[model samples]
Target: MTNTILGNISFENLAREKAEYPRLHMLKPESFKHIEIKNFEKVEKEISFEIGYHRGRKRWCLDIYTHRGIRCDGEIKFFSSIPAIREFIRKEYQREPILPAFNQKSATSNFNI
Candidate 1:
């Protein structure tokens, strides 16, 4: 069962698909305001990936925000151990270029003085 905010696609379903991770929404300082966790540390933070620990839950969780039809606000994938979380992230979150890098040379070539 899934809620309206988080769709029905589980982590397993996502692993099977060929889609890459989604683009991240620009996080503001207020983003952590709602996530009231005491001993939590943001272990990983990237443009589209984030991993944090919830001391109370004793679990490592990754954010479930994606542009690829997997939009979830508060939903997350939790892991039991640090190793498990690391390995899972390595396998699932393949560091692939979702968008082409900006080529400065090409852009500058077209500029007229």
Candidate 2:
């Protein structure tokens, strides 16, 4: 069971297969006005959050909001391959190395991204 909203929200269910910056309609718009794939673009929103992948660091960073925004202050960072990003979300950054599932041919699991 996930205790965080990120864990609760399904990126695939949001229907963002083609969107470079995927977002969702918040059930309760209070916490997250909007959340999308973080990029270099400049966005204008009161409660905007971003999730990005850093190739250099080989990790993911989830920045909640800017200093001028409503959130108090904080950021979540973790390392995950493009395929394993789901695990990062499911585990909420507390991820261990994912081994192959049930003698699968590859390490990648069948998580619908």
Q: Give the candidate number with the greatest lDDT.
A: 2
Off by over 4 Å in 2: 1-48, 65-71, 91-113
Identify the leading candidate in terms of TM-score: 1
Residue 9's lDDT in candidate 1: 17
- Model 1, position 30, has a per-residue lDDT of 15
lDDT tens digits, residues 1-113, model 2?
Answer: 21123432422222334433323223322232333345866544444344554435545544444344554555655544434544654464333422222233221133222
RMSD of each candidate relative to the true structure: 18.8, 12.9
Give the runs in model 1 whose Cα sits over 4 Å from its true position: 1-47, 68-74, 96-113
User: What CA RMSD would candidate 2 show?
Assistant: 12.9
Candidate 1 per-residue lDDT, tens place, 1-113, comes to 11111121112113344423311221321121122234685333222445444545655556544332343334577776435544664466543322212233332232210
lDDT of model 1 at residue 83?
52
What TM-score does each of the candidates earn?
A: 0.32, 0.27
